[model samples]
Target: MSAAFSFNRIVAIGLWVVGGGTALFLIAPILAIIPLSFNAEPFFTYPMPGLSLRWYNEFFSSEVWKLALRNSIIVAVFATLLSTVLGTLAAIGLSQSDCPARATLTAILISPMIVPVVVAAVGIYYAFAAVGLLNSLTGLVLAHTVLGAPFVVVTVTAALSGFDQNLMRAAASLGAGPVEAVLRVMLPLIAPGVASGALFAFVTSFDEVVVALFIAGSEERTLPRQMWSGVRETLSPTIAAVAALLIVFSTLFLATIQWLQGRAELQKTHREE
Candidate 1:
């Protein structure tokens, strides 16, 4: 028993170390850029330069950046709404054991996530071009909705796992309609999952560049697309400010997900007890 305990302790320590190291590795670049965003020096090089908010000021004041930010918010909002509704419905439908072609339908729905973004972008470009949707806001929103739906489906499906379907039936027997049952019972139970899924969908659409690059016109350029152009055409500290902003947004989203998941777990445990 002592030997087994020691082995488990060692394994736990080793896993913690590995996890910490991997996280640092992934975050090092963003961390490095964030500090440089405040650097007073014109160049992106290292070493002490005075700190200032010049770049951040520039980002806020610039018309280009403002337009890009607006575009990003608009696209992300619509995409999140559409993806959440569609994906939640699909997840609920697919969760039923009696659903026809369930596996095939799931695969098709999630294919956007599995397939290469470049390939998907190319396909969307050609398809939208044919329908006069190319270079349009609607096209961008539709494209992002496709990319975001898979995350929602996966999140909601996980929330539904081990769920007691009898509760839904009980609601039905109480004279509750399908929509009422879903809204009153299922949604409350899975609210965390739905919120997490919607946030993920928003983040995915907001940060996406490749598909936007292929489809968006100059007038419809998103934050990521604008950043891509800035990086390629002009090396500036404003880009660093944008990167820092994105990092902050990503961190907040991650923290929100962790909190929601923890809350969900507590709720589940309380119910079980």
Candidate 2:
């Protein structure tokens, strides 16, 4: 009923509109690509020349695409596994009182996220080349692990933000060793965060192209790298199909994280009740 309250309400509504419009603007082009992917014609353009599934079939059947997808999966899986373990351990240590140089250590561990991809790629390329890892699956996995670990560290650290230190001590008093306490008590509570982090790592590795371009050999080409080559050499509707599939993959990961977070919240609430 008050004039001041009405003014504030209008401002809030205006901000919401602006935010929604911006999101739509960013997402519109990507959404547009999805439909064009199914176009019967080989070109990526507006309006269908008739709908078809040939591009999707090509992606599934092509040896090049299959090889690229297989390489991506292998790298993503190993990178996710390594990053989750290392990041979770680092986060647990950094959360403790006696952890030394925590700030510096964290910055070092997460620097991959802060550094530009191009720069990281250049540096990694040289490092691996020196070690004779160039153009190898091992090199690709290691490169991706560097980029993916920070997500795990950040998520796990946040999950531990509200953790009670005394709970670990209590478990210790009950005859649980440090490792046992972490496994038996701390891990269950943070499983959702770890899973979320692992998904992020997997997606990061799966979608990354720059580092893959630099370090991956011909045999180790990932899906994104394959798409990049397709764009450069022979632009076709198949690229759009690949893009659509990637967008779908990203959406699935995002949805899974939301589900995990929601379940974590429900468990927390039930415990409180």
Candidate 3:
């Protein structure tokens, strides 16, 4: 008994150390960005010269920044809509399938997430330029949707894992068609997950700089693209202000998803009873 207990303790301690180190590595860059954003210096240096909102004010007042924010929002909204529709349908289809190839199909669907953004963007940029989609919102939306679909697929897959397909059958037996069953029965249940996935898709597109950098120059500049340009041209706190705003927005969206998911689980329980 003493030997087993000692072994378990060693395992637990190892896990804790690994998990803490992994978390710090992931979070260090973002935590660093926050402090630098508030630095009073014109450079991306830190000496804690006292925090100021001056950079944020400049970001807000700048016309270029405003336009980039507007563009980013537009692209993100469109990309989210596209990914939500396509990904939800794909998820439902995959879940309903009994084929042996389902795993392969899933891999194909999510390949975008694994593929290098630069390579994908390069190919897309050339294609769009050839097809007159370069420097256009339409091109940007399509590229972002391709990139964002994987997130929607992954989230909805987890949600569907907890779903009871029988409820769908019952609705259909009560004279509902597939579309009606999905909308009235499945959707109300999985809508929370879909909503969360949409939020993630929005974030993916909003922060995407690589594809935007290659495909859409100033004509379709996003907030990230603008920030990239600022970094390359000169250091400015205005970028920090932008970063802070994004951090706040992401935090709020995550909180909303958690609340919605909790309510969804409660509703599912009540229905089961």
TM-score of 2: 0.93
Task: Write down the TM-score of every candidate.
Answer: 0.94, 0.93, 0.85
lDDT of 3 at 193: 83
Query: lDDT of model 1 at residue 258?
Result: 91
1 versus 3: better lDDT goes to: 1
Error of 2 at 217 (Å): 1.0
Residue 28 of model 1, lDDT score: 96
Write one digit per residue (lDDT tens) for candidate 2, span 144-211: 99999999999889888767678899999999999999999999988988898999999999999999
Instruction: Rank candidates by lDDT, best first.
Output: 1, 2, 3
In candidate 3, which residue pairs clash? Answer: none
Q: Give each model's whole-structure lDDT.
A: 0.94, 0.92, 0.87
lDDT of 3 by residue, 180-239 (tens): 999898887888888888988998999899999988967679999999998899767788
- Which residue runs does candidate 3 get wrong by more than 4 Å? 1-25, 98-101, 257-273
Query: Residue by residue across 49-133, what tens digits does model 1's lDDT show?
Result: 7899999999999999999999999999999999999999999999998999998999999999999999999999999999999
Candidate 2 weakest lDDT stretch, 10 residues: 264-273
